[model samples]
Target: MKSSDKRKKRLPKPLLSDMEEIEMDVLSLEEKISYISESLFNTDDLKIRELTFNNKKMVILFIDSVIDNRNLQLNVIKPIIEKSAGDIQNVVNSNNVKETVYLDEALCAMVDGHCLLLMEDSDVLTYICIPKVMRDRSEPINEKVIRGSHQSFTENITENIHLIRERISTPMLTVKYSSLGKTSKTKYAVVYLSHLTNPEIVKTIEERISYINVDSVQSPGYFEEFLEDSSFSPFPQYINTERPDRVAGNLMEGRVALVMEGSPTVLLLPVTFFSFFQSTEDYNNRSLIGSFIRFIRLISFIATLCLPAFYIAVISYNYEIIPVEIIFSIKSSLEYVPFPPLIEAAIMQFTLELLREAAVRLPNPVAQTIGVVGGLVIGTAVVEANLVSNTMLIVVAITAISSFVIPSNEMSTSVRILGFPLMILAALFGVFGIVIGLMFLLIHMVNLKSLGHNYLYPLAPLDLNALKDTFVRLPIWLMKERTKDLKPQYMWKMTNPRGWKKNEESK
Candidate 1:
């Protein structure tokens, strides 16, 4: 055989063969019970009760932790015992009642919080839904807004869907469900508007998700990492949010949302770099104020990415660029420090990151205390000990605050991480190195894709119509079309939302 053929033969198979198909068995009641007990290793929580009704032996099986005891008693047991019905399905007041002869299917239903009923001399088994636990729908703690609905998504997928359905209330909205994770069987939903969303984008998302070969999907983060277009890029191609209003807004704009059963965070797909800086509160406020805040966010993005590098360049090799008065003060402060500009910046930035992580991990009250006290104590001690210059301290402080200005925490973290490389380049080649680093960064972003769509849309692709809503919030009437980059099915959102002005002018 050729060497290439040998290499091809060494590759692993494409599909998993771990989950074997089990055939259904036509067994007696005692044999069925024995099979379930053996399959589950006779666990303690697997409660199987035998009851006599109309000279028939009926068996009930369920896991204690996931079942509603009262419902099982009143709906299934009470009706069967009191009514003495031949058909147990008629007496049960449950919505999800089904008959199956497969032991694997019956076991799967019982594991999913359903109660199973088997009668002697009968070839069928019945299962009813009796799930007991659910989390309460509460306001999002992370993505709070001053002027919007307070509700957020919960761990329950059905409740999360209800939250979105309540907001949109349109027949065009559709949700498709599928299971992921071979071992966990984690369920997730792909939701979008059938008439508004691009069909190609939906198909791509579905295919990517369907092809994920994993043993478990513990959270939405797993899906985000697996479904993203580029794994090497630091930037997050998909936007994850806990706010239902934000998901609803994106759905209306012809984007797809992935909501998982066990995760509160919903993933919004085909997002651009600019999408991370947007806030739902932007549209909640006046257009002018919203535009101003967005502009500040954009400035913060630049400052967070380049401030440390710019500081390093100026202090290390381009002191001439700084004003004479400011340069004297900076020089005087640095004269007492023993480390080079690069070392000082690295030390201070690392310390700032440590404090940030510490504050996040601590309790709210303790975190507030640590944030204020730790910064004051550590910053003062370092400066007084001549470890870092005061100017570098101020630069690091400003850079840290600018990173926090970003609306998305994941993007904020990526921006902060991107600064480290830029600072290193600045140390090596001064301003020239900074420029080269920025060029490489720009090239990477230009080439990146979010679900096969440009990552730097409206800026790289140069869509003038979309620019109105990119860096600034134009009046609602002015943004008459959806984002052109997504290739939405319906482009014109409103022909003329401000048509009243034309009538008034003509009169």
Candidate 2:
């Protein structure tokens, strides 16, 4: 051969043989191992354990990184070696065991936390399910609870499902798992109480999930955006929570939760505008106290979104509406400020947002220090320099505080952003602009749907019966029905919960 032809002949051949192209089962154990090793590019984590069962050679193949070695030995290896001479079916004690002759199937099994067994003179390959390494559950920092269970969902999908099952403890609770993402192949589960959740809603959730086509889905956010009915709406279509207790509670009331592998945050779907206002503390507190807190939260939500705009409107065009005592106090505060009310309020609000963002980015103790010190320094300096009004600073502080009062971070952020447009509108047309802006917002919400369910729920649809649990939560016994907005299969979740009390009264 010529020098050029000799080099081409000496070059390495492709790793995959013609058998793979033909999709034929390779019966030889050594060839199968070679195929897999080459298929994975001879990865460092590939492990092989060889043993003799009654003098018959057997090999175990797995990835060291994906599986728990101790679990594999205790649950699989012990049973097989100790119970030799019997069929593999009777010897292994693993949860799932399957035999396959196809190399592709065996490779997939190995990657999914399974150990493949190949015995001498046997063409069939057996795969046993092995425990996968997973992280332990910890309380979510963002959604803390004072009185309820502190456990939150972990990145492990199975453990998250187990937590929900432990709380509900009923066969009616259903979980359906489906793999998503073409490259990532992320696993996700849809959980709901079958007897309570509407089948149509479940179908809708599934259909929406099926529509997502992506290489990777890293968190619940990807699924949320794909599944949402309105992508442009500022309101979140799902309640993203990590607390298992909170998810269990929502499931009991006939909502669906999407749990994704490798993500701790679970998505509670078809939630309403009011649903964002609820907190886990609401149910833990006494009924009257919870109701008062809910009312305050709703009020604070309004103030968070409209306080700055309202302030701008009053000083710019509706100072006539101000009380005689308060008008002088406000006018005196604004006397030295050179900027218009709009510019002053905007600057203060922007500065507050910067401080808030800094607090989130810094370490906990440092963040607290910066928040307090920064606010005092900025507030004092701005007022003394006649750059911003004292009254405007107060409005910005109240607005920031009110935004924090919102339990859901998504809604809190959206409200903060929506304030700017309302501010512009108010500056242009004053109180009428605020009313007109609010009217358009209401109309949009009324038209918005979350997975085909009303976004504003009982308020927009005016379902009087469901209002009992909307603005204020009634006592557990009195609030027997599930919210109509969810369209739960069973409306009355409780009946005669107080029958014993009624019986005592009769006695």
Best-matching candidate per TM-score: 2
- Mark the 10 consecutive residues where model 2 has the least summed lDDT: 3-12
- In the range 1-507, model 2's lDDT, one tens digit per residue, is 121221110111221111232423334568767876765445444689887775688888986645678888987788777876677777777658898666666766665667889887666779987846445658778887778788888887777776776676443556777889899899988888766788899999887787888999999999988989899998898999989888999998889999999988899988999999898899999989999999998998999989999999999999899898999999998888888988998888888889989999999999999999999998999999999988888889899999988899999999999999999999999999999999999999999999999998897788888888879988888887888777787787666787665446553
| TM-scores vs. true structure, each candidate | 0.74, 0.75
Name the lDDT value of residue 453 in candidate 2: 90
Best by lDDT: 1
**154 in model 1: Cα distance from truth in Å?**
1.1
Give each model's clash number.
0, 0
Candidate 1 wrong stretches, greater than 4 Å: 1-135, 502-507
Q: CA lDDT of 322 in candidate 1?
A: 83
Quantify all predictions' global Cα lDDT against the true fold: 0.83, 0.81
Question: What tens digits encode model 1's per-residue C-alpha lDDT throughout 284-316?
Answer: 999998999999999999999999999999998
